[model samples]
Target: MTANRRPVIVGVDGSPAGLGAVRWAADEAVRHGKPLRITHALGVPGPFEQPFEQVVDEHDIALDAATEARGWYPGLHITTSTWHGSPAHVLVEESRHASLVVVGSRRTGGFRSLLVGSVGLQLAARAYCPVLIVHNAERWAAPESPLPRQPIVVGFDGSAHSDFAVGLAFSEAATRGVELVAVRAWREQARRWGRGADLTRLAAAVRDALAADLEPWQAKYPTVPVGLRAVRGTAAPVLLAEGSDALMVVLGPRGRGGLDDVRLGSVTQQVLDHASIPVLIAQHA
Candidate 1:
């Protein structure tokens, strides 16, 4: 399929979190003018034969999610499917044909509430398309409701992947008619030696680098109000603090020091684990 025709895919597991993901996916499909694909993974069978009834139940999960989405977005085009594999694997395969994949950050218990599920983490690391992990789904407004005038926060460190992230963030901000906050974090060894002047110079250089990186995107998206933040700290903490009330946090799958062997970067993983708002992991097709 063409890129514009690629569907917005969402995985459902019959849980409240899964249903919430369906709602978010529906709204996104409408916004992008793409079809919505609601799917359920039946999971890999064990040593013993899987029950036929379990397959039927899984099919029902996908159908129910489609029904819920249709009710909320009556005009949106949607499709439903069921696959026999792990949720992460199935969604990763589906991502090959999708524009975006969305799932909920299902909180199972106390500590888990602060982290995304195994499937979400896996998709963030491996999906071919961007993966969106929706958090605090209960507060997500209706499709026609106006979004808060919060900015879309994006982390950029001049890596090729982060450059793509900056572009995506600008598109999202423009689409929502909101501001775009581009944050670049740096570590200053001078601070440890109490060298105030050196630290000031370092901060200035970093800010100039960030501005240069953002120059082209700002020109391309002239209407998107851009805010630049050059902070002296680690990426994850700075992003989480700045995006506390953001519409969503956009990030690359990896960063400047990311190894080719590593599918996900440490900073992205840290933010995904703790972000209370939606997190979008940008991927190159």
Candidate 2:
């Protein structure tokens, strides 16, 4: 791997989800023509002291993941590293120099009800680079033949954070030669003085605002076809449904309606927790 080029990093922990992340990351590295870096975290010691053999077993796990990735992309440049720290910390640090960090929606958990794993949640909120969470790699597996281009969905709320998300989404769509769908979801508030007509007018205003916000990005990526969707509903459900067939869903850490004190916005949290497709959280450059 070249020293200057930023590799796409993926965390592996020998779980089914970890394998899914590996496959998705390998495809991304190939699509972007970048190097692939597979990482496994040998977490800090806790109450239970691990035997020497167990530590060696961890190394074996990482090695197996690297081997599997190589099988998928024989010509791609692949590198593997093991970090001695928490998975979240190690991956977050790796994100500092990575073009993108791809991970599974959830890892091995005792409870089957756990939707998104803790490591994924931490990285979504704190990663330095864009974090891509692949929920179902099997459904998103790379096709052997060239398939029709899928659109990239971006949840736009006309906020500063959405600005970054728009930029990233446009770039990805342009690179992949795919369509970009910029969505803005709104909800009508009950008014004491007005009737149902007032709510309809408000919805129209939100739609117009969404179109205006997306105009600049459309102009910037003229080669990339753009689709503007403004609907009356919650942002999370709208984005989730739109992203069902998209290549990936892009969102900001916060939206226009996000609380200032919260690290992760409500819309982002909901999508990250429930979206079945890959979700990309766009952070500041």
Name the best candidate (by lDDT): 1
The TM-score values for the models, in the order shown, are 0.89, 0.84
The global C-alpha lDDT for each of the candidates, from Candidate 1 onward, is 0.84, 0.80
| Candidate 1 per-residue lDDT over residues 1-285, each given as its tens digit | 999999999987776777777887887899889999998876764432667886677699889888878889899999999886778888999999999999887556232221237778889999999988987554553445443568999999999999989888998888788999999999965455543557678888998999998999999999999998898888999999999999899999999988988999999999988998899999755
| Overall local distance difference test of candidate 1 | 0.84
Model 2 regions lying over 4 Å from their true place: 1-4, 46-56, 106-116, 138-149, 198-201, 257-261
Model 1, C-alpha of 135: deviation from truth (Å): 2.1
Candidate 2 residue lDDT tens string, 18-60: 7777888887788888899988887773442678788778777
Candidate 1: which stretches are off by over 4 Å? 46-54, 109-116, 141-149, 190-196
